[model samples]
Target: MLDLGITGVQWYARIPGTIGGAVFNNIHGGTHFISEVVKKVKVLDKDNKIRTLSGKALGLSYDKSRFHDFAEIILSVEFELFRGDAKRAKQVAFEWAKRKSLQPPRSAGCTFKNISNEDKERLDFPTTSAGYIIEHILKMSGYKIGGAKVSTSHHNFVVNDGDATAKDYTTLVKLIQKETKKKLDIDLVPEIIFLGEFWFGNVPGCQGGGVSSTPFEERVVWD
Candidate 1:
């Protein structure tokens, strides 16, 4: 985007994954969300037919989208952007990259979604951040299971300190959920999508069901 003299997506510089994945997850950075720039998307619907969906049809929201519930293949996407100085955009991206330098070197990014505003208010918490709850409330930073460890630098990230298997990662995630529920009575929702069948320890919305053989079956379609 910077090379193309486009702005508004500089926040994505610190985010992992493709643009389509960002849209699918409705990924956000700071106060800006990918959904803010989305204009429309072309998709292959469940009927095996092509369709264009825009606005509410996409069901874009915080760290969520219709892609979470529907089986569709994203073919292409149009984004609204502003013409900006490439030099300025690059500078902003560089700044964001440096600020996010604490991200775990080997991790899948944030493990849990931020608490919803409703939960935050109900819990009487000052912030809706799941990382804050993990690190401050539960005091689970640096907690480890097998080779998977909750990153001390950023509590939301679970890092693989080498030799960490898929089971190790899933086990650590379950532990986080367990501790959160036990301490705060809040169910921490996972942010990363599960690929294969794995243990989820009775986490709501994540019980049973692994990645399906069909690509369009409750899949994240990258445009």
Candidate 2:
């Protein structure tokens, strides 16, 4: 935002959700993220006490922040931004949004975060694009499971075209991971979070979704 010709932040404009989620996921566009502009954040800790946390105190890093799993409520954030030309800011944000629009309209942004440098070396993978491995090598773009399909536009996006369910998404995700692991000896971790229970047979509650949850059963694969 521009205030009397001074800019507060441009990065936050790129993210879709609230500031809390942005900080939690280290939401980024362009090269910087919320962590860069955030001066401090006020969070309600598990003890129900409101406390202010500085950026460094949160240990903000690439695609991660202390708030990721901590039991706390992010009340608000304080940002410190630089003053830049209005046209330049708009151009930057436009470029970022244009890039984001290339993915599936119904899908999550990126299913898998870029591999860390250390993990990349350990896995003997040369490139950072996990999507490349899935799309180029594994050839999984447009791969489908039930109602969900990997975005042909970008391999990482999982799109729900119709009445898709969690099972469809998870099944496709597992299939990709399994294939990638078998082919490249690399284990790809997901960036998206699973909110509800994931019943994948190995888990105790999941009996191929036939135990009780009828609504969830229709979505499971080969059940």
Candidate 3:
């Protein structure tokens, strides 16, 4: 878009995924959400019919959307944007990418969503960031179980130290959830999606979704 002098959606420049994934996840960068600029969407519905949907139908809110409930595939999207300085857009995107470069390479990015602002104030926490809580409050940066360890570079990231298994990953996540809940009465909900039959045990936020009786079935364990 920057090539055409577009500016509004530059917040997504550092996000790693397709436009469809951005809308489905309602992924946010800085303080801007991808949903903010979305004007319309074209989707392949469950019936395999093409349909146009207004942006409001997306049900977008902090890492959520109606896409979680519908068996649809996003075919295309329209965004409301404005003509702006391509030079500035490039600069902004470059800065965001530079910041993201500090994250560890062996991880799937942040493991948990930050606590809601309401929850932060109600619980008497210092900040809404989950990484802050884990690193500064819980002091669990570099905390580990099996081959999975919380990244010291970023506390909310769970990085694999060479030989991690699905079991190890889930186990470490559960431990973080348990500790956060125990210490602060706050549930550390994961932002990561789990597939297959990985045992989450007593993890609070995971639930089954997507199509049933097929490969897509149980693909997203987020709720």
What is candidate 3's lDDT per residue for 1-223, written digit by digit as tens?
7888989877666667898889988989889898888999999998999999999999998887878777789999999988988899888888878878887888877899899999888878788889998898889888878889989988889999888887788788877888888888888878876654353322333334222333222343332
RMSD of 1: 5.5
Candidate 2 residue 141 C-alpha distance from true site, Å: 1.1
Clashing pairs in 1: none
Clashes of each: 0, 0, 0
What TM-score does candidate 3 reach? 0.85
Deviation from truth (RMSD, Å), model 3: 4.4
Tens-place lDDT digits, model 1, residues 64-145: 7888678888889989889988898798789778877868889998888888889899989999999999899988899888
User: Where is model 2 more than 4 Å wrong at Cα?
Assistant: 2-12, 117-127, 199-223
lDDT (Cα, tens digit) per residue for candidate 2, span 1-223 = 5544556455446556777778877887656767777898899998999999987888787676776546678899888877778777776667767776565778777887776678667757776888878788898878888999988878788899787888898888888878877887767777775544354344454444333323223323323
Alpha-carbon lDDT, every model: 0.80, 0.72, 0.80
Off by over 4 Å in 1: 1-5, 84-91, 121-126, 199-223
TM-score, cand. 2 vs. native: 0.80
Query: What local lDDT score does residue 22 receive in model 3, on the 0 to 100 scale?
Result: 90
Worst 10 residues of 2 by lDDT: 211-220
How do the predictions measure up, each by TM-score? Answer: 0.81, 0.80, 0.85
